[model samples]
Target: MPSFSHDPLSPKDAADVVIVGVAARGLAAAARRAGLRALVLDLFGDDDTRELALAAIPLRRIGAFAIDPADLYEQLAIHAGPDIPVVLGTGFEHQPEVVERLAARFRLVGNGPPTLAWTKEPLMLARLLHNLGIPHPQVFADHAPAGMRTLEKRIGGSGGWHVKPASESRGWGWYLQEELQGRTVSALFLGNGHKARLLAFSEQWCEPSEDAPYRYGGAAGPIRLDPSIEASIASALDAVVNAAGIVGLASADLMLTGDGWSLIEINPRPGASLDVFDHEPLPPLLRLHFEACRGELPDLALLTPEAAGMVRGAGVFYAPFSFEMRLDPLPDWVADRPPQGTRIETGEPICTLFAAGRDVREVRDTLARRRDQLWRDLSMASRKAAE
Candidate 1:
């Protein structure tokens, strides 16, 4: 077993920075490319992230720091020291009180208080976009009438939530929308102050599902846009940044509706397809994130024609036969090692697969193949165990 220690701050340490969630692709890759000696910390022991960290940095210098998000800063401060550069990779809502308390102690890099505050609700973000005249899907947090079809979403969540077809339900707020057959769009933004730039725009298809409205089955490469549409998106992005005074990673989900486009709410943090930028090179956004951390503004650049996409990476969980009584070891394949930065779970998200290709269709096809293969492997392993 790996020995765990709380004393992170040693004078002999060579790492210039400590990346909190190296399990995340963007964070790990950024730290790696920056050539910063990085130590990755996460609750579940991740061999993939550990291997990637070593590969990205020097094997001798790279280190792995595994701890729950709840114990993050204190552990780092105790062992890694107070001056280590820290970037948060966990959700903003997971431990709000702890984040607030540790705000002043570490050299933390992230969005401001308001940006974090606004993202707590879909309706609040929609109101901001609507008031600014940014084009977005018509969204209402209030109950839909008798005959309209709408998508109920968790205001504070992403990556799908329990989506019940509701003529009427309350408490869990959702993004109510009429089902439209177009494209689901996401554009990445980076900026400081009121001025911002569009980094990339990816057009995706939410796999048609009568059962899973909130779940996206797969996605495709970044859609190369006609100049006119790109311009409209750029103008709208600039307007949003100006209005919000936001300057980190922001993504807009839009739909190509008939002759015009409808805007979905903006995700204040990096979204599911952040790795798309990695497929094609877009260093400006990555640079901007670093700049923001340094309290410096980065130059804005227009997005090029390069495209990239992602298929929905799904997971299968094995629930205990009953309740908490069956505390067995996480099964073999579920506990199997994944590629670097591939997320894993013991009971919930067992495994995930990502694929990229020349176009959206190819990418979608590739993802489907990978997903199917993973399920087959897991099913076979399970059946063999039973036998």
Candidate 2:
């Protein structure tokens, strides 16, 4: 039987929480900040993750993009003690069945399989948005709409990497949607199945490469929004929470276009923006998630001026070429650090760089400078080795 322990500070001998994801560093960090002992399972058991987690295990990768579900289940079953509640992150978004299977075996926190299926289904979400009178991009399942610029996206795909031009033919599990050009914004919220409270609003950016055009680059904010715009988004979210029965931490991706704000998709989990929105004085997000899941909503008054005004940004620094990762005593600014002597292929993400400041522009600038400097340092090291 699954176990539920309200005490986050359980003995270090056993895990109080187990976090599973494609990259679980952020979630593990949040759990640690909340005074919980977390066991992390992900594809990259990065250096920071190991430091934060009681135990860290790498999930098996299938090809360059997919996680092997069987491997994930086997690892979880081996490490997750009976009754230990599991918190899922990025990897299982594409495999709801796997999540369902895991939930059947272990105590799964956050949203259940039904909630995930309801929110992740493109057609269902589009219809819900339409019925709510919210602006949303038109989605077509299994076929492209005639004579309109559309993008092909995979079901259960997160991080925007799975999106491509509709002109290209792909295998099954693909759907087409009208492309919108505008500012990409994400709203992070805490919900209790009936209502949701906004935690932060962030501007999302993508880094397009030859292979992954819509690759998630980074995010910046807790940005101030026009009162009217914020109201509209809040109203949309309220409708969504009631409609989908979303509980705990969730994010809504939308585009502010010439027409208006159009809903993109909903991430029913602790998303990438957790790092940008996480601040002190307020309880850690993972704690808030746990509280909200138990039907308690966090107090919005806890959002202090410092927490709301402070802007944080993170950018993924991709390897410019195939090189071995070698940063001894890794810089404090860099995270998701691969083990030394690990061979990284060209275009693969190297590490994530983070910066925080009072001004969003300054934070973004600092992140950019840091990213460039790290790449230059890597290039110089490579050249020296060759010489």
Candidate 3:
């Protein structure tokens, strides 16, 4: 049996749960709600994550983009103790080898490294989908087929920034896929190796910049899906889970187009849409995630139905220019907050903004208004600080 510890201040001690991710806030919050003490290791140990977690350790950043995996392993070893159950989040899809190593060292609570490697490999996933009769974007593993509109994507990249035009000729670890025009949607689900239960469907939004046109911006859901469309998606999810042995929380990205839905990619861990879909009276998603991983899925009928009626949205507010943090009283809706006095570089995410309503459009509008308000407030404070 694995040992569990609740102490946060003692790094050498064990923890009940250890969550590693790029942004640990959502998972940490879910853990807290489940009455579990979690030690968080991530790139951004945001204020909320720190508060929710028993302890939060930031991974050593490699330049502006990635984290040092060696540092991550060192910190996990120091804080995780023996046989502690660890749950991985974002920032790991690209590091399957590291994930495999970590699994050998700790009791990883979600999908195994082998599953991650297979699902995250574009060519492999494309083949698997093809065999299952699951529709996915046409992939060109070597080069773009001449005269067809295609996007270049990097293996192990998340948040969509790693995607670009195939014509640009970016170096290795890249593949081309025929681009499709449609509404980007994500389905969040829980799997138990052989089957999956749907949780919510969300519309994915992107914020385009000259450097990253595909950069992820936000998500809104539980967007109503046509009955036929919903069934198709659910069937596809079940096929993938059965084929790949997917366990725990996972999300699939798809393009809803005139022809039909086409799979874009799969996030084989807890995803960004977590905050928007999770609600009260239902089990915390982390708890469900752990249960699913152990092959003990809850009665799908017991899961709350409120998520279907309520709408929620979350958006990342990027820093417009290099500036020192000066917004003193952070608003209630802001999350993933950097500490005051931290210098933020242009294009870096400042914080996440959230809003909820009875419908998707309402929540989306509220999120936009909140985002603009936060930007104005932060900008005003920066100007005053310079004076």
Q: Model 1 — TM-score against the truth?
A: 0.73
**Estimated TM-score for each candidate:** 0.73, 0.93, 0.94
RMSD of 3: 3.3
lDDT of 1 by residue, 40-145 (tens): 6554334445544532211111222222444565466654556766556544432344446556676666555566555445566677777878776555566776
Model 2 agreement with the true structure over 1-387: per-residue lDDT tens digits: 113375464333478899988899999899988889898888888878998888788889998756798898788767886588889988777778988898899888888888887788888888888998989898887666567788889888987788888844375677788888998988999889999898778888888988678989899887766678888888889889888899899999989886478889999999888787766655789999998898898778424336565778888888879987655766798988888777889888898889988777788889988888888777776666666
Q: Predictions ranked by lDDT, top down?
A: 3, 2, 1
Which sections of candidate 2 miss by over 4 Å?
A: 1-13, 167-171, 301-309, 383-387
Tell me which of candidates 1 and 3 scores higher on TM-score.
Answer: 3
In terms of lDDT, model 2 sits at 0.82
Model 1 misplaced regions, further than 4 Å? 1-13, 21-26, 54-69, 73-82, 93-99, 138-142, 145-147, 162-164, 172-181, 205-212, 293-347, 381-387
**Model 1 global lDDT (CA atoms, 0 to 1):** 0.53
* Candidate 1, residue 379: lDDT: 51
Alpha-carbon error at 52 in model 1, in Å? 2.6
TM-score computed on alpha carbons, candidate 2: 0.93
Rank the candidate models, highest TM-score first. Answer: 3, 2, 1
